[model samples]
Target: MVRQERAIRTRRAVVEAAAAVFAERGYTAATIAEILERAGVTKGALYFHFDSKEALARGVINAQISDDYWVPRELKLQEWVDIGMTLAHRIPKEVILLAGIRLSADIQGRSLFGSAWPAWTQLVTDKLVEAKARGEVLPHVTPRETAECFLGAWIGTQFMSEVVSDWTDLNDRISVLYNHVLPAIATPAALIRLDTAPDRGARVVEEVERQQRESPVPTEA
Candidate 1:
């Protein structure tokens, strides 16, 4: 158990180090030596987890989608909003996420390792499908189509935010995105109940943490 936990930690550290380097330098320019130095892990250890820089980039991309800080809500639309807002909040703070964004956008890297956009689109599609099933969305709204359009808008927003404000205004941009887009696809009731505030991400994270703390731990019978 201890060995497994240690391996997990090591792998996480390697991925984080790679992310930092990739975020600072484009995937083509990032070096394994820099990542190794940042991680303070031996070559063998890094190779054990990630055989190459491409693999490390893939790991960072995979880590971009997680439900660790997500909490269920009465409104599925609200949950979808939370996912975007929380990611907006986290992107500036997390190296892995930032790296994922950079790698996904890199023209050369896209050909080599593919992009994270497909996975993100799928996630949104699944959520929107659930929301449609619950009658939170308009009947004519197709989840996959909506997801693709939203993902395109999201990538454009990120790029604009990066260029215009160096990503300091990303949360606000995402909030505006939700405000404008949700009204078109969501039911009136769901739209009214959804929170797309710029600070909604921070609040949702706090709520998730509180729920986690208040929940009872399960024990084996």
Candidate 2:
């Protein structure tokens, strides 16, 4: 049991190190030697744990999105918005990596679409669909279309946020969605007060960060 636990720790360290390296240098420029040095592990260990760099990159993204869990199937639209804002707060680095990947030529959408994107879209679509069904959203609103627009804007905003290091006003973005964007699709009454929701959501988001920090998960190893 102790040996297994140590192996898990080492693998987590590798993913984190690789993620940091990739975020700073990008995928094409990042090398296995850099990842090894960052991880402070022997080359053999990294090779044993991951067959290649591509697998390691995928692992990094999986850690970011699902944390290896199945996606949530049910939520109100407001809840979905809360989750996005909170995730950005907790794992800004990982979110940046995703943005970097999308912009990078080395990685393709198909590599992650079945595993990650569908799960994300499903979560967004489910909430939008539920909100429309519940009359929280206007009947004319197309859940799929709204989901795409919301997700595109959210991802784009995260990327732009990265380019500007000093600006950390995700709440402002949420406010725009609530007051302007979402209202255009749904009723104003359906809009959530993010200032209030973040208070509760912050706790949940912190718990997620704590879990990822304290209990390291096994990766390729």
Best by lDDT: 1
Candidate 1 — which residues are off by over 4 angstroms?
211-221
lDDT score of residue 177 within candidate 1? 97
Clashes of each: 0, 0
Off by over 4 Å in 2: 67-75, 91-116, 187-189, 192-221
Estimate TM-scores for all models.
Answer: 0.93, 0.72
Candidate 1 C-alpha RMSD relative to the actual structure: 2.6
Q: Compared with the true structure, what per-residue lDDT tens digits does model 2 show for residues 1-221? A: 77787878888888888878877776667789999998999888788788777777767756665533222433365576666666655545354345334423244533632234555677778878887887778888888887778777776666666577532665455445544566677665665433324343465566566877898776544
